[model samples]
Target: MPDQAPVRSSALPVSDWQQALDTVLQTPVKARPYSAQIMRQSPTAFLFLIDQSGSMDERTTYRGRVLSKAAAVAQIVNQTLLELALRCQKGDEVRHYYDIALIGYGGLNDEQAVSLWSGAAVGKFFLTPAELAGATLRVDEVTVERNIRGRAVTVTEKRPVWLNAVHNYRTPMKSAICLAESLVGQWLATQQGNDVYPPTVINITDGVATDATADELLACCDRLKALRSMDGNVLLMNIHVSDERGNSILFPARADDLGTDQYARLLYDMSSEMPTPYHADIASLFGLDQRTSYVGMCSNADMDALVKFMNIGTPTQHNHSFTANLSSEP
Candidate 1:
């Protein structure tokens, strides 16, 4: 047979990769609310604004041990990070279901805020579960009490440490929030679609912002909360830790519930309203009746209340089915 010219394939030229990429990117993503199930494809983000102000040096009781407020906050935050890593663990693999940032303010004499990631993840603003798992600064043995078969027993376990307690200078809360706003804005810009659950910002502070007035701080928070995804607005939760033994006000439903305390009311105003999907979890976690939505701010929180408040702010608790599915996978 006579040689014939080769026919061109129907596929587009390899040089047209950008057009193919644009086509894939332009596909419509179904929009969902805050109830969207978090998975590897649409992972969530957590930004922790930790207060390392001079007031954090005050003594407080945490997990039955007396320590500085900074120490207690570090412990709780470390535990929370560990729990998040564990949740993302399926078999031997640590899935990337979250991007976490830990920013500590007022920890230096210069009143600067900076990333708190230690070890391999030092100087990074955001981290994946696998990165966090490998970035431990140290490991310490921790003792805890547990009930088994109607008997209470104490046990010791090794806990990895990433953040350390640092108490110095004054609270630069406004600066920290502004930095968070910048970081979150950049993060949301990179998200593939609007259906990803909005980032959650948990501000753990012991005192008022030294750089900004109450109104200014609230304005900063307003700007942060206004940055939203299809799942919902960015959830800004404030936790005011105190050494005083006063009763803590948590998840209050009204400004009236905050009484005449001007700072508490300001925090209430700064907080994002608790999303409807979280109402059931809040009720179950705090033993409250789910009649109305609550504010995301907690005032005068001691170490114990601080832990409970942190639990409610974190998005991991809402992904029970995700964890179950991961467990069942081979």
Candidate 2:
């Protein structure tokens, strides 16, 4: 037989070795994708999937006081929305930098997973920053400490309450993840050609899925990450609110960091990898070194870590000027 030309790995016909080399070199390298910034002109969405199962009713100590997981989640969601709204605030109006969703799983009256907002907001999946500000059911005051002149000082601030604490019978986590996927898909469709940031889905649960098996939950997570826009795919974050007391795990690079807990490892696998720019913020805010691989997940998170996780997930580069309202010791 006569000598034949070289063939590429794909078995494509090539005249010579150079042509095969060219074909190999022509293979495109995919860029490492990252999360997009939420802006006014091109806004992003935030879908909060909360587990309101009966297990959430189990009380746990947070900040010297005991509160149920349901209570913690409600406070965290409301506070996070408030912070996002503040970030979008310019002059007197709230910029539409984000569209927010609050989906609660395992409710008695509601189905498996449904929008927990009341009145006209029940059927709505996404709410603008302004709409979120107005959707609050009530406002209550809470006291927090701030470091002033190297001393902790108490301060009182008005806190808005949106979703109330609810402890239901079963945890329909599969339904919650499915709802999140649907909402994320719809949001991505709206930003088809735009350079808008991809939506972020954060699921705060007790690490127990009563409605579906482990495989089904993982499938739902895969579906969520598959939804994308021009900027990037949806970022899925999970917070396992364990009632067990001890050191809480934040942003673990390996499954070993999560100990031998299978559920925690599962959540770690199902989470989005932390983006580059977010590393600094995570390290600075939560003191977690993200130079290494760490997915957006926290297992058995305490109240402080839970709040920090929320702040880390929704970030703004804008710096605001503030005037002192209190008298200084100096």
- Scored against the true structure, residue 170 in model 1 reaches a CA lDDT of 90
Stretches of model 1 off by over 4 angstroms after superposition: 1-32, 145-155, 315-330
Evaluated at residue 140, the lDDT of candidate 2 is: 95
**Candidate that scores best on TM-score:** 1
Q: How high is the lDDT of residue 296 in model 1?
A: 90
lDDT of 1 by residue, 1-330 (tens): 111111211133444533443432354433545765567777888999999888899999986789999999999999999988987888889888789988888886435567777676655778898898667778999888899999999999999998889898899999889888867766666674545677899999999899888888888898888876666678899989987867678888999988899899989999999867667766776777786778998899888778878777764554532233222333
Every model's Cα RMSD, please? 11.2, 14.0
Which is the leading candidate under lDDT? 1
Instruction: Give the lDDT of residue 245 in candidate 1.
Output: 68
Lowest-sum lDDT 10-residue window in model 1? 1-10
Candidate 2 residues lying further than 4 Å off, grouped into runs, are 1-32, 35-37, 109-111, 143-156, 316-330
Given candidate 2, what's the lDDT at residue 179?
A: 78
Pairs of residues clashing in candidate 2: none
Query: Which clashing pairs does model 1 show?
Result: none
Clashes per model (N, Cα, C within 3 A) = 0, 0
User: Residue 153 of candidate 2: its Cα lDDT?
Assistant: 98
